[model samples]
Target: MTNTHIKTLTAAILFVPLLAFAAAPGSTDSIETRHGRVDVIADADATHLLVAGKKIATLGVGSASLFRITSAAEREYIIVQGSRPGLHCHYSYRLLALSDSGPKVSKEFGECLDLGGAGMSGAEPVVHLNSRVDPEAGVETYQWQGDDVNLVFESPTLCGATGFVAQKNAAPVRAPLASRVKGSGRLQFLSAPDAGCAMPGVFVVPGDKVTATLASAAFVYASYTNPKSGRKVQGWVPRERLSDL
Candidate 1:
Protein backbone atom coordinates (compact mmCIF):
# COMPACT_ATOMS: atom_id res chain seq x y z
CA MET A 1 0.00 0.00 0.00
CA THR A 2 1.13 3.60 -0.63
CA ASN A 3 2.45 5.57 2.45
CA THR A 4 -0.44 8.07 2.41
CA HIS A 5 -3.02 5.27 2.06
CA ILE A 6 -1.49 3.31 4.98
CA LYS A 7 -1.58 6.45 7.21
CA THR A 8 -5.21 7.12 6.31
CA LEU A 9 -6.21 3.54 7.08
CA THR A 10 -4.38 3.62 10.47
CA ALA A 11 -6.11 6.79 11.51
CA ALA A 12 -9.54 5.45 10.52
CA ILE A 13 -8.93 2.28 12.53
CA LEU A 14 -7.95 4.29 15.65
CA PHE A 15 -11.00 6.61 15.33
CA VAL A 16 -13.58 3.82 15.00
CA PRO A 17 -13.44 2.79 18.65
CA LEU A 18 -13.73 6.38 19.80
CA LEU A 19 -16.85 6.90 17.74
CA ALA A 20 -18.28 3.63 19.05
CA PHE A 21 -17.71 4.50 22.71
CA ALA A 22 -17.88 8.28 22.92
CA ALA A 23 -20.88 9.49 24.92
CA ALA A 24 -23.09 12.28 23.64
CA PRO A 25 -22.89 15.75 25.20
CA GLY A 26 -25.25 15.10 28.08
CA SER A 27 -24.90 11.35 28.53
CA THR A 28 -22.75 9.17 30.70
CA ASP A 29 -20.39 6.54 29.35
CA SER A 30 -22.12 3.33 28.36
CA ILE A 31 -22.26 0.61 30.96
CA GLU A 32 -21.89 -2.80 29.38
CA THR A 33 -24.12 -5.52 30.83
CA ARG A 34 -25.24 -9.02 30.07
CA HIS A 35 -28.61 -7.69 28.98
CA GLY A 36 -27.19 -4.86 26.87
CA ARG A 37 -25.39 -1.52 27.06
CA VAL A 38 -26.89 0.87 29.62
CA ASP A 39 -26.75 4.66 29.29
CA VAL A 40 -28.16 7.76 30.91
CA ILE A 41 -28.95 10.59 28.51
CA ALA A 42 -29.77 14.08 29.75
CA ASP A 43 -31.61 16.85 27.98
CA ALA A 44 -32.70 20.32 29.00
CA ASP A 45 -35.57 19.07 31.14
CA ALA A 46 -34.79 15.50 32.19
CA THR A 47 -32.50 12.50 32.15
CA HIS A 48 -33.39 9.16 30.60
CA LEU A 49 -32.06 5.64 31.22
CA LEU A 50 -31.77 3.42 28.18
CA VAL A 51 -30.76 -0.21 27.73
CA ALA A 52 -30.00 -1.43 24.24
CA GLY A 53 -31.62 1.70 22.89
CA LYS A 54 -34.85 1.00 24.84
CA LYS A 55 -35.95 3.67 27.31
CA ILE A 56 -36.26 2.16 30.77
CA ALA A 57 -36.81 5.12 33.12
CA THR A 58 -36.49 8.89 33.45
CA LEU A 59 -35.61 11.45 36.12
CA GLY A 60 -36.54 15.11 36.47
CA VAL A 61 -34.15 17.85 35.34
CA GLY A 62 -30.70 16.63 36.42
CA SER A 63 -27.45 15.19 35.11
CA ALA A 64 -26.39 11.62 35.77
CA SER A 65 -22.93 11.44 37.26
CA LEU A 66 -22.83 7.72 37.90
CA PHE A 67 -24.02 4.77 35.81
CA ARG A 68 -22.97 1.15 36.20
CA ILE A 69 -24.13 -2.43 36.03
CA THR A 70 -23.57 -4.67 39.02
CA SER A 71 -24.49 -8.23 39.88
CA ALA A 72 -25.41 -10.13 43.04
CA ALA A 73 -26.58 -13.69 43.54
CA GLU A 74 -26.30 -14.13 39.79
CA ARG A 75 -28.78 -11.33 39.04
CA GLU A 76 -27.76 -8.20 37.16
CA TYR A 77 -28.74 -4.65 38.08
CA ILE A 78 -28.29 -1.09 36.87
CA ILE A 79 -27.61 1.76 39.33
CA VAL A 80 -27.76 5.43 38.40
CA GLN A 81 -26.86 8.42 40.60
CA GLY A 82 -27.20 12.11 39.94
CA SER A 83 -28.08 15.49 41.41
CA ARG A 84 -31.66 16.00 42.56
CA PRO A 85 -33.59 18.46 40.48
CA GLY A 86 -33.52 22.01 41.84
CA LEU A 87 -31.46 20.94 44.84
CA HIS A 88 -27.79 21.81 45.07
CA CYS A 89 -26.90 19.75 48.11
CA HIS A 90 -29.10 16.74 47.46
CA TYR A 91 -28.79 13.84 45.02
CA SER A 92 -30.96 11.03 43.66
CA TYR A 93 -30.61 7.39 42.61
CA ARG A 94 -32.47 4.82 40.58
CA LEU A 95 -32.07 1.05 40.83
CA LEU A 96 -33.11 -1.23 38.01
CA ALA A 97 -33.01 -5.00 37.55
CA LEU A 98 -32.44 -6.84 34.31
CA SER A 99 -34.88 -9.43 33.04
CA ASP A 100 -35.97 -11.18 29.89
CA SER A 101 -38.29 -8.27 29.17
CA GLY A 102 -35.50 -5.72 29.72
CA PRO A 103 -34.38 -3.46 32.57
CA LYS A 104 -36.91 -1.79 34.89
CA VAL A 105 -36.70 0.55 37.81
CA SER A 106 -37.26 -1.26 41.12
CA LYS A 107 -36.53 1.58 43.51
CA GLU A 108 -35.91 5.33 43.46
CA PHE A 109 -34.43 7.52 46.23
CA GLY A 110 -34.22 11.31 46.18
CA GLU A 111 -32.96 14.21 48.24
CA CYS A 112 -29.90 12.29 49.35
CA LEU A 113 -26.48 13.74 50.08
CA ASP A 114 -24.82 10.77 48.35
CA LEU A 115 -25.60 7.31 47.01
CA GLY A 116 -22.87 4.84 46.03
CA GLY A 117 -20.72 1.86 47.03
CA ALA A 118 -22.68 -0.74 45.14
CA GLY A 119 -21.49 -4.13 46.34
CA MET A 120 -22.53 -7.59 47.50
CA SER A 121 -23.50 -8.79 50.97
CA GLY A 122 -23.67 -12.54 50.74
CA ALA A 123 -26.31 -13.15 48.11
CA GLU A 124 -27.74 -9.64 48.25
CA PRO A 125 -26.70 -6.42 46.54
CA VAL A 126 -26.10 -3.60 49.01
CA VAL A 127 -25.90 0.18 48.62
CA HIS A 128 -25.56 3.14 50.98
CA LEU A 129 -27.80 6.22 50.97
CA ASN A 130 -27.07 9.23 53.15
CA SER A 131 -29.63 11.92 53.91
CA ARG A 132 -28.87 15.53 52.95
CA VAL A 133 -30.80 17.33 55.67
CA ASP A 134 -30.39 14.85 58.51
CA PRO A 135 -26.73 14.38 59.33
CA GLU A 136 -27.60 12.47 62.45
CA ALA A 137 -29.55 9.94 60.46
CA GLY A 138 -26.18 8.55 59.29
CA VAL A 139 -25.98 6.25 56.28
CA GLU A 140 -28.81 3.91 55.30
CA THR A 141 -28.15 0.40 54.03
CA TYR A 142 -30.34 -1.07 51.29
CA GLN A 143 -30.47 -4.55 49.80
CA TRP A 144 -32.06 -5.89 46.67
CA GLN A 145 -34.32 -8.93 46.52
CA GLY A 146 -35.41 -10.10 43.11
CA ASP A 147 -36.96 -6.92 41.72
CA ASP A 148 -37.59 -5.22 45.06
CA VAL A 149 -35.45 -3.05 47.32
CA ASN A 150 -35.41 -3.28 51.12
CA LEU A 151 -33.96 -1.00 53.82
CA VAL A 152 -31.83 -3.36 55.86
CA PHE A 153 -30.15 -0.91 58.19
CA GLU A 154 -29.70 2.75 59.15
CA SER A 155 -26.45 3.68 60.87
CA PRO A 156 -26.68 5.77 64.00
CA THR A 157 -26.47 9.55 63.69
CA LEU A 158 -24.96 12.01 66.14
CA CYS A 159 -26.08 11.65 69.73
CA GLY A 160 -28.16 14.35 71.47
CA ALA A 161 -29.76 15.07 68.14
CA THR A 162 -33.40 14.32 67.27
CA GLY A 163 -33.06 11.82 64.42
CA PHE A 164 -32.81 8.07 63.75
CA VAL A 165 -32.31 5.84 66.76
CA ALA A 166 -31.93 2.13 66.07
CA GLN A 167 -34.03 -0.10 68.29
CA LYS A 168 -33.10 -3.74 68.58
CA ASN A 169 -36.17 -4.58 70.64
CA ALA A 170 -39.40 -3.06 71.81
CA ALA A 171 -38.05 -2.24 75.25
CA PRO A 172 -34.57 -1.48 76.55
CA VAL A 173 -33.00 -2.66 79.78
CA ARG A 174 -32.03 0.95 80.39
CA ALA A 175 -33.62 4.11 79.10
CA PRO A 176 -31.74 6.61 76.96
CA LEU A 177 -29.33 8.72 79.01
CA ALA A 178 -26.19 10.79 78.77
CA SER A 179 -23.01 8.88 79.53
CA ARG A 180 -19.24 9.00 79.20
CA VAL A 181 -16.75 6.41 78.05
CA LYS A 182 -14.90 4.62 80.83
CA GLY A 183 -11.30 3.33 81.05
CA SER A 184 -8.21 4.96 79.58
CA GLY A 185 -8.33 2.85 76.39
CA ARG A 186 -10.60 3.50 73.43
CA LEU A 187 -14.05 1.97 73.25
CA GLN A 188 -14.91 0.43 69.88
CA PHE A 189 -18.21 1.03 68.06
CA LEU A 190 -20.05 -1.87 66.41
CA SER A 191 -22.53 -1.76 63.60
CA ALA A 192 -25.17 -3.71 65.51
CA PRO A 193 -26.00 -4.60 69.09
CA ASP A 194 -24.49 -8.04 68.69
CA ALA A 195 -20.77 -8.64 69.01
CA GLY A 196 -20.88 -10.53 65.73
CA CYS A 197 -21.70 -7.28 63.90
CA ALA A 198 -18.68 -5.71 62.26
CA MET A 199 -16.89 -2.84 63.99
CA PRO A 200 -17.07 0.41 62.03
CA GLY A 201 -13.57 1.45 63.23
CA VAL A 202 -14.93 4.34 65.30
CA PHE A 203 -13.77 4.71 68.87
CA VAL A 204 -14.22 7.01 71.83
CA VAL A 205 -11.52 7.56 74.43
CA PRO A 206 -12.00 7.97 78.15
CA GLY A 207 -14.20 10.93 79.15
CA ASP A 208 -15.70 11.32 75.65
CA LYS A 209 -19.38 12.07 76.10
CA VAL A 210 -21.95 9.86 74.42
CA THR A 211 -25.69 9.52 74.45
CA ALA A 212 -26.51 5.95 75.27
CA THR A 213 -29.85 4.68 73.96
CA LEU A 214 -31.50 1.34 73.18
CA ALA A 215 -29.63 -0.37 75.96
CA SER A 216 -29.62 -4.14 76.09
CA ALA A 217 -28.30 -6.36 78.81
CA ALA A 218 -24.75 -6.33 77.49
CA PHE A 219 -24.63 -3.54 74.91
CA VAL A 220 -25.85 0.00 74.55
CA TYR A 221 -26.28 2.05 71.39
CA ALA A 222 -23.92 5.03 71.70
CA SER A 223 -23.72 8.12 69.55
CA TYR A 224 -20.53 10.20 69.65
CA THR A 225 -19.88 13.55 68.05
CA ASN A 226 -16.42 14.89 67.30
CA PRO A 227 -16.12 18.40 68.67
CA LYS A 228 -13.76 19.77 66.04
CA SER A 229 -14.76 18.03 62.79
CA GLY A 230 -18.46 17.92 63.72
CA ARG A 231 -18.47 14.34 62.42
CA LYS A 232 -20.70 11.78 64.13
CA VAL A 233 -20.74 7.99 64.48
CA GLN A 234 -23.04 5.70 66.36
CA GLY A 235 -22.95 2.00 67.16
CA TRP A 236 -23.19 -0.55 69.90
CA VAL A 237 -20.79 -0.40 72.81
CA PRO A 238 -20.57 -2.82 75.70
CA ARG A 239 -22.67 -1.53 78.56
CA GLU A 240 -19.74 -1.89 80.95
CA ARG A 241 -17.62 0.43 78.82
CA LEU A 242 -19.72 3.49 79.62
CA SER A 243 -20.58 5.33 82.82
CA ASP A 244 -23.58 7.52 83.53
CA LEU A 245 -22.58 11.19 83.37
Candidate 2:
Protein backbone atom coordinates (compact mmCIF):
# COMPACT_ATOMS: atom_id res chain seq x y z
CA MET A 1 0.00 0.00 0.00
CA THR A 2 3.01 2.30 -0.03
CA ASN A 3 2.38 3.10 -3.73
CA THR A 4 6.13 3.08 -4.49
CA HIS A 5 7.02 2.91 -8.21
CA ILE A 6 10.11 3.03 -10.40
CA LYS A 7 10.99 3.96 -13.96
CA THR A 8 13.87 2.69 -16.08
CA LEU A 9 15.32 2.82 -19.56
CA THR A 10 17.48 0.22 -21.29
CA ALA A 11 18.03 -1.26 -24.73
CA ALA A 12 16.62 -4.79 -25.09
CA ILE A 13 14.01 -6.49 -27.21
CA LEU A 14 10.52 -5.85 -25.76
CA PHE A 15 9.56 -9.40 -24.87
CA VAL A 16 12.84 -11.14 -24.07
CA PRO A 17 12.18 -10.84 -20.37
CA LEU A 18 8.58 -11.67 -21.07
CA LEU A 19 9.76 -14.92 -22.61
CA ALA A 20 11.62 -15.69 -19.43
CA PHE A 21 8.62 -14.67 -17.34
CA ALA A 22 6.45 -17.01 -19.35
CA ALA A 23 8.95 -19.85 -19.04
CA ALA A 24 9.88 -19.70 -15.37
CA PRO A 25 7.68 -22.28 -13.65
CA GLY A 26 9.97 -23.14 -10.78
CA SER A 27 10.06 -19.72 -9.15
CA THR A 28 7.06 -19.53 -6.84
CA ASP A 29 7.75 -15.80 -6.79
CA SER A 30 7.23 -15.71 -10.55
CA ILE A 31 4.73 -13.14 -11.80
CA GLU A 32 1.41 -14.07 -13.24
CA THR A 33 -1.50 -12.18 -14.86
CA ARG A 34 0.27 -10.00 -17.41
CA HIS A 35 -2.29 -7.97 -19.36
CA GLY A 36 -0.03 -6.67 -22.12
CA ARG A 37 3.70 -7.49 -22.18
CA VAL A 38 6.84 -6.05 -20.61
CA ASP A 39 10.64 -5.93 -20.32
CA VAL A 40 12.88 -5.51 -17.28
CA ILE A 41 16.32 -3.90 -16.95
CA ALA A 42 18.94 -3.74 -14.29
CA ASP A 43 22.00 -1.85 -12.99
CA ALA A 44 22.32 1.94 -13.08
CA ASP A 45 19.14 2.37 -15.09
CA ALA A 46 16.90 1.62 -12.11
CA THR A 47 16.89 5.32 -11.25
CA HIS A 48 13.82 5.85 -13.39
CA LEU A 49 11.19 4.25 -11.14
CA LEU A 50 9.08 6.84 -9.34
CA VAL A 51 6.31 6.66 -6.77
CA ALA A 52 3.51 9.10 -5.90
CA GLY A 53 4.89 11.29 -8.70
CA LYS A 54 8.29 11.28 -7.03
CA LYS A 55 11.54 9.41 -7.71
CA ILE A 56 11.72 6.29 -5.57
CA ALA A 57 13.76 3.20 -6.59
CA THR A 58 16.65 2.72 -8.98
CA LEU A 59 17.85 -0.28 -10.98
CA GLY A 60 19.44 -1.64 -7.79
CA VAL A 61 17.50 -4.84 -7.55
CA GLY A 62 18.36 -8.54 -7.11
CA SER A 63 14.88 -9.94 -6.86
CA ALA A 64 13.09 -11.18 -9.96
CA SER A 65 11.02 -8.69 -11.96
CA LEU A 66 7.98 -9.21 -14.13
CA PHE A 67 6.50 -7.24 -17.04
CA ARG A 68 2.83 -7.71 -17.63
CA ILE A 69 0.06 -6.20 -19.71
CA THR A 70 -3.38 -6.86 -18.30
CA SER A 71 -6.45 -6.00 -20.35
CA ALA A 72 -9.97 -6.62 -19.13
CA ALA A 73 -13.32 -5.11 -19.97
CA GLU A 74 -11.87 -2.49 -22.32
CA ARG A 75 -9.05 -1.62 -19.98
CA GLU A 76 -5.33 -2.35 -20.40
CA TYR A 77 -2.68 -2.29 -17.72
CA ILE A 78 0.94 -2.43 -18.85
CA ILE A 79 3.07 -3.17 -15.82
CA VAL A 80 6.71 -3.81 -14.82
CA GLN A 81 7.33 -4.99 -11.32
CA GLY A 82 9.73 -6.86 -9.04
CA SER A 83 8.85 -8.97 -6.07
CA ARG A 84 10.10 -11.57 -3.57
CA PRO A 85 8.22 -14.62 -2.37
CA GLY A 86 5.36 -12.99 -0.44
CA LEU A 87 7.65 -10.22 0.72
CA HIS A 88 5.97 -6.82 0.49
CA CYS A 89 7.99 -4.34 -1.55
CA HIS A 90 5.54 -1.46 -0.85
CA TYR A 91 5.46 -0.29 -4.48
CA SER A 92 2.70 -0.53 -7.06
CA TYR A 93 4.62 -0.34 -10.34
CA ARG A 94 2.94 1.71 -13.04
CA LEU A 95 4.60 2.67 -16.30
CA LEU A 96 4.54 6.33 -17.25
CA ALA A 97 6.07 5.26 -20.53
CA LEU A 98 8.59 2.72 -21.75
CA SER A 99 11.99 4.27 -22.52
CA ASP A 100 15.50 3.15 -23.34
CA SER A 101 17.01 4.30 -20.06
CA GLY A 102 14.11 2.38 -18.39
CA PRO A 103 10.63 2.97 -16.97
CA LYS A 104 10.10 6.75 -16.82
CA VAL A 105 7.98 9.13 -14.74
CA SER A 106 10.03 12.27 -15.27
CA LYS A 107 8.35 15.14 -17.09
CA GLU A 108 11.20 15.50 -19.61
CA PHE A 109 10.15 12.13 -21.00
CA GLY A 110 7.43 11.82 -23.64
CA GLU A 111 5.11 10.54 -20.91
CA CYS A 112 5.22 14.08 -19.58
CA LEU A 113 5.47 15.94 -22.88
CA ASP A 114 2.70 18.36 -23.80
CA LEU A 115 0.55 15.29 -23.00
CA GLY A 116 -2.53 17.23 -24.04
CA GLY A 117 -5.05 18.26 -21.37
CA ALA A 118 -6.66 14.95 -20.77
CA GLY A 119 -7.18 13.59 -17.23
CA MET A 120 -5.35 10.30 -16.69
CA SER A 121 -3.91 7.83 -14.15
CA GLY A 122 -6.31 8.86 -11.37
CA ALA A 123 -9.44 6.79 -11.81
CA GLU A 124 -9.86 4.15 -14.49
CA PRO A 125 -6.76 5.70 -15.99
CA VAL A 126 -5.46 5.17 -19.48
CA VAL A 127 -2.66 6.94 -21.36
CA HIS A 128 -3.82 7.62 -24.88
CA LEU A 129 -1.72 9.20 -27.64
CA ASN A 130 -2.25 10.03 -31.31
CA SER A 131 -0.05 12.99 -31.94
CA ARG A 132 1.00 13.87 -35.49
CA VAL A 133 4.48 15.24 -36.14
CA ASP A 134 6.07 17.06 -39.05
CA PRO A 135 9.83 16.71 -39.18
CA GLU A 136 10.45 19.06 -42.09
CA ALA A 137 9.25 21.90 -39.90
CA GLY A 138 11.35 20.78 -36.97
CA VAL A 139 8.59 19.32 -34.79
CA GLU A 140 9.78 15.83 -33.83
CA THR A 141 11.72 15.80 -30.62
CA TYR A 142 12.82 12.99 -28.32
CA GLN A 143 10.29 10.34 -27.21
CA TRP A 144 11.35 8.04 -24.35
CA GLN A 145 9.00 5.35 -23.04
CA GLY A 146 11.44 3.32 -20.98
CA ASP A 147 14.98 2.67 -22.26
CA ASP A 148 14.36 0.38 -25.20
CA VAL A 149 11.87 2.67 -26.97
CA ASN A 150 13.19 6.23 -26.99
CA LEU A 151 12.92 7.88 -30.44
CA VAL A 152 13.41 11.24 -32.10
CA PHE A 153 11.12 11.84 -35.02
CA GLU A 154 12.89 11.58 -38.40
CA SER A 155 9.97 11.93 -40.76
CA PRO A 156 9.58 15.57 -41.65
CA THR A 157 6.65 17.54 -43.04
CA LEU A 158 4.53 14.56 -42.11
CA CYS A 159 1.00 14.24 -40.76
CA GLY A 160 -1.08 12.13 -38.33
CA ALA A 161 -0.02 13.94 -35.19
CA THR A 162 -3.51 13.88 -33.78
CA GLY A 163 -3.21 13.35 -30.00
CA PHE A 164 -6.68 12.52 -28.74
CA VAL A 165 -8.46 10.37 -26.15
CA ALA A 166 -11.97 10.15 -24.77
CA GLN A 167 -13.31 9.67 -21.25
CA LYS A 168 -16.85 9.38 -19.98
CA ASN A 169 -18.18 10.05 -16.52
CA ALA A 170 -21.66 8.75 -17.33
CA ALA A 171 -22.55 5.71 -19.40
CA PRO A 172 -22.53 6.83 -23.00
CA VAL A 173 -23.36 5.18 -26.28
CA ARG A 174 -20.23 6.13 -28.23
CA ALA A 175 -17.09 4.40 -27.07
CA PRO A 176 -13.98 6.36 -27.86
CA LEU A 177 -11.27 4.76 -29.96
CA ALA A 178 -8.76 6.42 -27.66
CA SER A 179 -6.55 3.37 -27.36
CA ARG A 180 -6.61 2.79 -31.09
CA VAL A 181 -6.47 6.47 -32.00
CA LYS A 182 -3.95 7.47 -29.37
CA GLY A 183 -1.80 4.46 -30.17
CA SER A 184 -2.08 4.90 -33.93
CA GLY A 185 0.81 6.71 -35.66
CA ARG A 186 0.96 8.49 -38.97
CA LEU A 187 3.77 6.25 -40.20
CA GLN A 188 1.50 3.25 -40.71
CA PHE A 189 -0.06 5.14 -43.59
CA LEU A 190 3.23 5.08 -45.48
CA SER A 191 3.11 3.04 -48.64
CA ALA A 192 5.19 -0.10 -48.40
CA PRO A 193 6.47 -1.80 -51.52
CA ASP A 194 7.75 -5.37 -51.66
CA ALA A 195 10.68 -4.00 -49.63
CA GLY A 196 10.80 -1.33 -46.94
CA CYS A 197 12.65 1.95 -46.50
CA ALA A 198 16.19 3.15 -47.29
CA MET A 199 16.73 5.89 -44.77
CA PRO A 200 20.47 5.36 -44.99
CA GLY A 201 20.69 2.98 -42.01
CA VAL A 202 18.11 5.11 -40.36
CA PHE A 203 15.01 2.85 -40.42
CA VAL A 204 14.21 -0.66 -41.57
CA VAL A 205 10.53 -0.87 -42.51
CA PRO A 206 9.06 -4.36 -42.07
CA GLY A 207 7.03 -5.61 -45.02
CA ASP A 208 5.15 -8.41 -43.27
CA LYS A 209 5.09 -10.05 -39.85
CA VAL A 210 8.57 -9.32 -38.49
CA THR A 211 10.40 -9.86 -35.24
CA ALA A 212 12.10 -7.24 -33.07
CA THR A 213 15.39 -8.80 -32.13
CA LEU A 214 18.10 -7.43 -29.88
CA ALA A 215 20.23 -4.62 -31.39
CA SER A 216 17.68 -4.26 -34.17
CA ALA A 217 16.09 -0.87 -34.89
CA ALA A 218 13.34 -0.65 -37.43
CA PHE A 219 11.00 2.28 -38.05
CA VAL A 220 8.21 -0.06 -39.13
CA TYR A 221 5.19 1.26 -41.02
CA ALA A 222 2.45 -1.31 -40.93
CA SER A 223 -1.33 -1.80 -40.91
CA TYR A 224 -2.57 -4.44 -38.50
CA THR A 225 -5.78 -6.09 -37.27
CA ASN A 226 -6.96 -6.22 -33.67
CA PRO A 227 -10.04 -7.98 -32.35
CA LYS A 228 -10.62 -4.99 -30.12
CA SER A 229 -9.99 -2.29 -32.68
CA GLY A 230 -11.21 -2.23 -36.27
CA ARG A 231 -8.06 -1.45 -38.32
CA LYS A 232 -5.25 0.21 -36.49
CA VAL A 233 -3.72 2.79 -38.78
CA GLN A 234 -0.12 3.89 -38.07
CA GLY A 235 2.32 3.82 -35.24
CA TRP A 236 6.05 3.28 -34.85
CA VAL A 237 6.00 -0.50 -34.79
CA PRO A 238 7.73 -1.49 -31.59
CA ARG A 239 11.01 -3.15 -32.48
CA GLU A 240 8.70 -5.64 -30.77
CA ARG A 241 5.58 -4.87 -32.78
CA LEU A 242 3.38 -4.03 -29.74
CA SER A 243 -0.12 -5.01 -30.65
CA ASP A 244 -1.60 -3.49 -33.85
CA LEU A 245 0.25 -0.27 -33.23
Q: Mind sharing the TM-score for model 1?
A: 0.51
Candidate 2 lDDT at 33 equals 28
Query: What lDDT score goes with residue 157 in model 1?
Result: 30
List, residue by residue over 73-168, the lDDT tens digit for candidate 1: 345665566665556665666676766676667667635556423444334455556654555556665667666787766555311111122342
Instruction: Put down candidate 2 lDDT per residue, 31-116, tens digits, no spaces.
Output: 32222223333332232333223344443333333443322323322333333234343222233343233333323223211111
C-alpha lDDT of all candidate models, in order: 0.57, 0.27
How large an RMSD does model 1 have?
15.9
Residue 173 of model 1 has an lDDT of: 40
Question: For this target, which candidate reaches the highest TM-score against the unseen true structure?
Answer: 1
Best by lDDT: 1
Worst 10 residues of 1 by lDDT: 6-15
Worst window of 10 by summed lDDT in candidate 2: 1-10
